[model samples]
Target chain A: MTVIALDVGGTSMKAALVPAPAEPGAGGEDVLASESWPTDRTDPVGGILDFAAHMAARAKALGRPARAAGIAIPGIVDEASGTAVHAANLNWRDVPMLHLAEERLGIPVAVGHDVRTGGLAEAVLGAGRDAGDFVFVAIGTGIAAALILGGGTYPGVSGWSGEVGHIVVRPGGEDCACGNRGCLETYASAASIARRYTALAAVPAGHSTPNGSVNVRAEDVIARAGTDETAARVWSEALDCLADSLAATTLLLDPGLFVLGGGLAQAGPALLEPLEARLAERLLFRPAPPLAVTRLGDRAAVHGAAILASRLL
Target chain B: MTVIALDVGGTSMKAALVPAPAEPGAGGEDVLASESWPTDRTDPVGGILDFAAHMAARAKALGRPARAAGIAIPGIVDEASGTAVHAANLNWRDVPMLHLAEERLGIPVAVGHDVRTGGLAEAVLGAGRDAGDFVFVAIGTGIAAALILGGGTYPGVSGWSGEVGHIVVRPGGEDCACGNRGCLETYASAASIARRYTALAAVPAGHSTPNGSVNVRAEDVIARAGTDETAARVWSEALDCLADSLAATTLLLDPGLFVLGGGLAQAGPALLEPLEARLAERLLFRPAPPLAVTRLGDRAAVHGAAILASRLL
Candidate 1:
């Protein structure tokens, strides 16, 4: 059975015509066709639905005859009611994406939180397949995670579970976009790392880079880690912040594995090694689970959406 | 349709011959008979078995003939294997408690983590009855909690899911008995509250209490909250620590309610009101869940154990 999977990301929406019920350990290679389009943040709701319609039409032209569709979006999603309660980045609130997609695509739509869907992909077919319990943390412009237990997504009663980014790691350190003081995202996120490094470069010190810039991207800081002392300090602190939150999450969930995904995960061992060491040092009796970059990488959400859609078949 | 419920605590063991499947809203009248005995911590394994046998024999002698027995113990238990992996407080390791109890009492045994069982009781019959997702945080000499999701205990892979006490709240604060630094227990537990208050009292003038005791108990400090400035300061700080951890848990789990139990819960609104306020302050977009004291109180574990036993029948 074929199902259409749409991963509605912050800047782009990727659509894939995928086989249903992902084969065990198949890594979602059964895609008949796939495409991508810019996500119109100006009118996020209409743009997403329009994108879904476009994908549906494309699948029809290819004669794939998709039976169902799964749309994975960032933010707080009420899966039970199929509503996107809040997506700060997209500025969406209570948008009935499932109902809208079904109306346009003429197929059942399964809606899920983006991070959770990515986590489902990992839990079912990626690095976390062997883990009965695990946390999937995606560190991009922001940090968020999904808790997979008993082989399924644990959507809290209100569909607001796994909002780990808002957890306060530093009580009064920095003001977060979430209107909170010192959230983990203000420190560990890819965006935060770059922002911190940029600020540090402004300091009048011997460690400051000669060509100081007001703004720097996370990749730039990571690229300069070995040679640039200021960048290294900022990068290490970011890892420390991430480890702190991960340790707290480990203490509560006691999961068997942690699957790291999103943009920062691309840093590979540069991110994982130090994180593992710091986490181990902080943990008491509980053993630290292996930390691995997501095997599916940026497409984990797409794979998860496909899996959810396949369930409709 | 009667079952035996046994709660094996650190200092004492309590047992109750409960009418099978205590109905929601059931009263104390459903508990036909109850007994208690000091627990032998030195030989915890043998002592627990002996206590179970004695309770079963007494219940049988009373003509109840319990259909099943449920035992709740404080430790890391592998419910699937019916083994107590470890209990630092009880000094038990790899104890096949369910099997031993079954052999000694001639009844099938259902074993579980004590705090988790208490959470089950609260989730099904007490303060959290209406909540589909909630946390049962029992702050006593040590801090521990039980996660109730979808109306059941969220026992992690090895039955060690709700070990929130070890979550690093202070990062690099005090050393915990669990061999970790800055654990929540080191700052927020009932024992920690007293310890903090006592440590504060040890300082020279202005900080010293009139009574001048270097070792004040949690109860004593709580009693002095309204009258003594030092006690109030310590109590407020403890509340802040608890609030920080609860906020972290809420962000991660998004539970609908928080059922406070154990010894510190006896403080009632004194604990709930401030905690609620602090949690609200910390949260971003999510609304704070209602925080209520556990209605089952100390008997929550026994009631929960009885419920588990009834499930076997």
Candidate 2:
């Protein structure tokens, strides 16, 4: 069976014609065709519909016409209604994605939360495959987690289950974009790390590398942590915040494992080792769950979208 | 059909001969016989087994013999194995509760975690019946929560979920019995509130109630909060810690409701009103779930145990 999978993010979209597994509960898949494009910020919904139509056309051209389509989008998604309730980055609110996609592509459509879709891929076929219950935490521009229990993402009361970023690790410490104080994201997100490092470095009290700019990325700050005092402080605080939140998660959920993904997870050992140690330190009783880097990387969401589409079929 | 249900705590036990629901998915139950006793701290397992046997005998005498039994126990429980992994207060370790109960009562047995069991009762037949996904938080000697999703308790990977007391709300604030600093339980648990108030009042600070002793209870501290400055401060800190933990829970789980139970919950409006306000204040973006007192009160666990026994039948 063939399906159209689209992972629509703030800046880019991963569109694919995926040959879904022929048998039930199958593991592997073959991508029939794939492409990427910058998200049309001004006409986001139109862009998504056009992309689905294009993917359907491509699938037909390959003589493997798509049976269903799946689109993984960011924000507060009402999956039951197939509506993108809100996506701050995309300036989207209540876009009837499933209806629009079905109208355009002439196939059953499934819409999923982006992070949760990524987590679905990880839970079924990636790092969390062996971990019975796990949390897939994506640390990109912002932090979010997907609780995968019994091999599926747990959408809490609403679709807002894993808003781990807003968990107050350091109450009344730092101002967050969410209008909260000292959220985990304020210290640990990729954007926050770079922003914090730059702000700290720009201050006159810094001893070395005082020249700060918005161009500085989390990777740069992580790389400079070895000697630069400001970078070290920022990175350390980020690790602490992440540890605090993860510790709370461990206490509440007690998942079998924690799978870290997204831009910051690229640090690999540098991120995992200290995080493991800090989480252990924070937890006085019970062994800490093992931490692992994402196995599927950025392609997770697209694959998960394919899985969602396959489920519809 | 009838079942034997027992809720064994550190200090007390609630035992009952409960009639199994006449129909599946029934709302109410009739207690054929009910009784309570001080827990046999020296021989907790023996006490539990004996209690089950007595309950079974009583059911038989009443011409409604119990076909199954359920025991709700504190501390770590391996429900799958029917073993009480460890109950600190009971000094129990790997006691084969189900096996012992079955041998003693000659019936199928079900073992469950105390807090989770209470949450089950709330989810199916009590306060959380209307709330789809809610966290049942019991703030007695210590704080713990049960995440009820789809009208059942969500047991994490190893059944060690809902250890919310250990969540660090104040990073370096107060020392907890779990050997952690700034845990939510340090400020919010019933025992902690009294302990904190006593400790704060003991020091030679200017206050009306400077004479501190172990005799003071959480209720006394809460009652005095209106007049006593130290009591007010202690109560405020407790509320703050609870609010912080609840905020994190809201972000992580986004439950439909929060069902508060145990000793502290007895404070009623004084606790609920301020807690609701603090939780609202802490959350910047999303709306906080409504907080309600447990309708089953102290009987939630016993009722839940009955539910478990009915499942066995």
Best of the candidates, DockQ: 2
Chain B TM-score of model 1, please? Answer: 0.93
Deviation (Å) of A21 in candidate 1: 4.0
Q: What digit string (tens of lDDT, one per residue) describes model 1 on residues A159-274?
A: 77788888887777799988987788998888888778767777433344566643567887898999999889989888888898888887787788899999999999989999
lDDT of each: 0.84, 0.88
lDDT of 1 at B198: 73
After superposition, which runs of candidate 1 have C-alpha atoms over 4 Å from their true positions?
Answer: A25-27, A203-215, B23-29, B203-215
TM-score of each model, in listed order? 0.94, 0.95
- Where's the lowest-lDDT run of ten residues in candidate 1 chain A? A203-212
The DockQ of each candidate is 0.72, 0.85
**Whole-model lDDT for model 2 versus the true structure?**
0.88
Error of 2 at B177 (Å): 1.0
True-structure RMSD for candidate 2: 2.9
lDDT of 2 at A281: 96
DockQ score for model 1: 0.72
